[model samples]
Target: MNIHFIAIGGSAMHNLALALHKKGYTITGSDDAIFEPSKSRLEAKGLLPKEFGWFTNNINSNLDAIILGMHAKPDNPELLKAQELGLKIYSYPEFLYEQSKDKTRVVIGGSHGKTTITSMILHVMNYHEIAVDYMVGAQLEGFDTMVHLTSENEFIVLEGDEYLSSPIDRRPKFHLYKPNIALLSGIAWDHINVFPTYENYVKQFSIFVNSLTNGGIMVYNEEDAEVKKVVEQATSSIKKYPYSTPNFKIVDGITFINTSFGEMPLEFFGKHNLQNMVGAKWICLHMGVGEDEFYEAISSFKGASKRLEKIAENNNSVVFKDFAHSPSKVKATTTAVKNQYSNRKLLACLELHTYSSLNTEFLKEYKGALNSADTAVVFYSPKALEIKRLEKISEEQIKNAFEQDDLIVYTNATEFKEFLFTQNFENSVLLLMSSGNYGGLDFTKFKDLM
Candidate 1:
């Protein structure tokens, strides 16, 4: 099949292109600008477009399908030409559903932690040599690509994001999956630009839960009040299995979960992570994995990329970088790092780069998020605000919202980078949290300091 991707440099879209390419399909994609990993990966696979800009000539009737990326605007030239030609255009999620509808779909959904849960399940399955199709948010250690599709696999595991499916599709991406086995990790308000009100944002999850196929199985976090409320109130005819943070003890910076089989030590830590593990366990059980086998596989699993990933470590100090920007994620990540290394002085740095994080009204949700750290630093680029067309935020506003009297804020990336270099790495742990680059901060430099 010939597939042409519109704005395919997206994290998810490019992965889909690669998956189809591996499947022996004719895959061609165009993007205005492609970044590091996506650009290099696409080039390696011989799927990168010859030029960077979209051309109407790329759209033709010979193409079997047009996969639209979230990065593409509604009026994108290639998209307009396709629409004019009456060509079939599928949103990323819509096309994925079309491909996996025949299989038992296992979708992990929430405002956060969905990626890790999905990755964990895939890791366990890979360890046992179980063949299953998957589309995860992060690039796992052993996985060649973020997405894999095969006609032979009977099941597919997907990280169900609550964000919009595509520019042309207003529905949440998870709603498109229509999973037979699903998990909702937790709910936290984000993407203020799209879902203006908190109520509206949560309503999307309600739609997602209700979208499950008949007799579907749902695994949810019972500890989260909002998630519990949603799952309990759902009138759909489905089986519900609720889980919470498993019993775990942190010994010598190692997190061990006391299971019925035995005490299992994990390479990962944090209550949120533990909660994700239990939820993944329920999904794995439903997928024909025994309890004992699940524990055995999970014990050897490292974490997904950028989710509290240990970037550097030394004899006395360590550095971590995470894809955490939401208020709940920021708070949870901060608390986890501080608790794991209680004896070390934790210096947590956060970058406010997302549209939701930069919103003046949404700032209040981050109140005391960094309180767990011994010292807290916040960074937001004025250039970022300008690019996002958001209102200019002041350091005072950030300090007031966090409710931390000693909070340090920086609007210039250069100054923040300079400040980062000056900090002492001895007897201290550093945690950098953001969904965006800290104005091009070199993460590898932290290893040398440690």
Candidate 2:
């Protein structure tokens, strides 16, 4: 099959392209811009476009399918040409559904922990040598690619994102998966630019829950008030299993799960993650994994990339970088680090990079999100605001929104870096949270300096 990707440099899109390429399909893709990792991976597979930017010539009837990425605008030239030629175009999720429709789909969805839950299930399955197709958001320790597809696999695990499927498809990506087995980790308002209101944002999850195939199984977090409300209201007669944080204890900075079999140590910590583990456990049980086996497999799992990844560590201090930008995520991540190392002084710094984080109205949701940290720092780039076409924010507004009188906010990247360098690393844990780069901060340099 010949597949041409429109705006293929996306994190998920590139992984899909690689998966199709591995399946022996003819894959070609184009994008206006391709960044690191995607560029290098595509180049490695001989799938990188010869040049940047879209070309109408790339669209042709010979292509079996056109996979569209969110990065592509509605009027993208390649997309326009495909439409002009009456070629079939599939949004990334639409195409994923097409590929896995014949299989038992297991989709993990929520405002947070979707990636971690999906990755956990994948790790357990892989440990037991169970063959399955899958797609996860972040890079995992042993996974070579973020996506994998095979005709022989009977199950497919998908990280069900609530974000829009594509520029041309207004529906949430999770709605497209139509999972037979699904999990909703939790819900916290995010992507304010798209949903506009909390009710509207939550309605999307309801749609996702309803989209499941008949007699589907749903695993949800009962501890999340918002998630519990959604689960209780769902009228579907499908089987439902609710889970919360499993019994666990922290010993010498390591988290251990107390199971029926024995006390199982894990490389991951945090109540959010523990809740995620229980949810994943239910999914694994439905997938034919015994409770004992799941625990055995999960004990070896470290974590998904950037969720709470340790970038550098020394005897006296540790540095972590997390893909945590939302209010709930910021709170959960900060609390996890502070709880794990209670004796250490936690210096938590977060970047206001996403549209929601930068919005003045949405800022109030972040109040006390960093309360667990010994010291809290917030950074936002004016250039980022300009690029996102968002209103300029002031340090005073950020401080007031956080309700932390001592909270320091920085609009200058240089000043932020200088301030970070001046902090004492002895008996401290530095947590850097963001969904965007801190104006090209070199993490390696910071690691070396610390």
Candidate 3:
């Protein structure tokens, strides 16, 4: 197959491009700018563009398909050229559906925890040498690429994101995959820039549930009322398997899940993660993995990248960085860290870089999100908000929204980094959460900061 990508340097887009290249498809792509990791990986695979900017010549009638990434606008030059040629254009998720339409798609979708849940299933499957094509948002330890596609695999596990499919397609990405097996972890209002109202934000999940194939399997988090409501309300003929946080004991900082086979010790700890494990277990069971195999394989699972990932640890202090920017994720991550290290002084820092986190109205949803942190610090760049053309935010607003009187706030990255360096690490757990780069912050320097 001959395929060309528009804006191919994205995290997901680059991974898909690499997967197709490995599949022996003739691939070409263009991106305005390419960052590290993506650039290096694509260059290594010989899929990197010859130049930085889009070229109209890149889109020709000979192309079999044009995979449009979210990074590319509807009026993008190359996109227009492809449209002029009457070529088949597929959104990232649309193309994924096209690739795995014949297989039984097991999609994991929710406001948070989607990446971790997808990673767990893939890890267990990989451990048992189960042959399946898959696409997960975060990179797993043994996986070479975030996406893997094969013609023979009977199943494909996908991390179904609820974000917009493309600039032109207003539908949620998860809705594109008519999954034969699906899981919805929890529902929380997010993507305020795309879905303005809370009802509108949640309706996307409802639509996703309704889109599942007839007589499919749905594994959901019954502990979350919103998720339960969505699943119960769906009129589909799917067999529902609801799961909650399994009974677990955290002994000496290690977590163990009490399973039917016995207790399984895990490298990661958190109530939310335990809940995710049960959900993943249900999906794996439906995919033909035995209960014993699931428990044995999951014991070796640490966690997905940037999902409560441990970065550095010393005698008295441990540091973790998470990709938590939404209110629910921030609260869940902060509460998880605090619950795990109850005796330690918890210092949690969150960077509000996303449009929803920076929005004035959406700030109220964050009420008490950082309350579990003994020391709470909130940081956001005014320059970033300006770039998004969002309304300016102030430290007072952040403090009022979080309802933390002693909350430390910083708009400057230098001051935030300096404050971090000056903090006392005596018997403390430090957590850094954000989806952004924290304003050119070099995380490697903090490896030995403890």
Which stretches of model 2 miss by more than 4 angstroms? none
lDDT of 1 by residue, 1-450 (tens): 999999889889999999999999999999999997999999999999999998999999999999999899999999999999999999999999999979999999999899999999999999899999999999999999999999989999999988888889988898899999999999999988999999999999898899999999999999999999999998898899999887789888889989877788899999999999999999999999998999999998889999999999998999999999999999999999988999899999999989999999999999999999999999999988899898899989999999999999988889999999999889999999998889989999887887
Per-residue lDDT of model 3, residues 1-450, tens digit only: 999999999999999999999999999999999998999999998889988998999988899999999999888999999999999999999999999989999999999999999999999999999989999988889889999999999999999999999988989999999999999999999998999998998889989999999998899999999999999999888888899887888877778777777777888889999999989999999999999989999999999999999989988789999999999999999999999999899999999998889899999999999999999999899999999898888889999998889999999999998999888888999999999978877887777677
lDDT of 2 at 340: 94
Candidate 1 displacement at residue 176 in angstroms: 0.6
Measured by lDDT, the strongest candidate is 1
Off by over 4 Å in 1: none
Q: What is the lDDT of candidate 1?
A: 0.93
Over 4 Å off, model 3 = none
**lDDT (CA) per prediction:** 0.93, 0.92, 0.92
Give the winner by lDDT: 2 or 3. 3
Listed per model in order, the count of residue pairs whose N, CA or C atoms clash below 3 Å is: 0, 0, 0
**Model 1 CA lDDT for position 178:** 91
- TM-scores of all models? 0.99, 0.98, 0.99
- Prediction 3 global C-alpha lDDT: 0.92
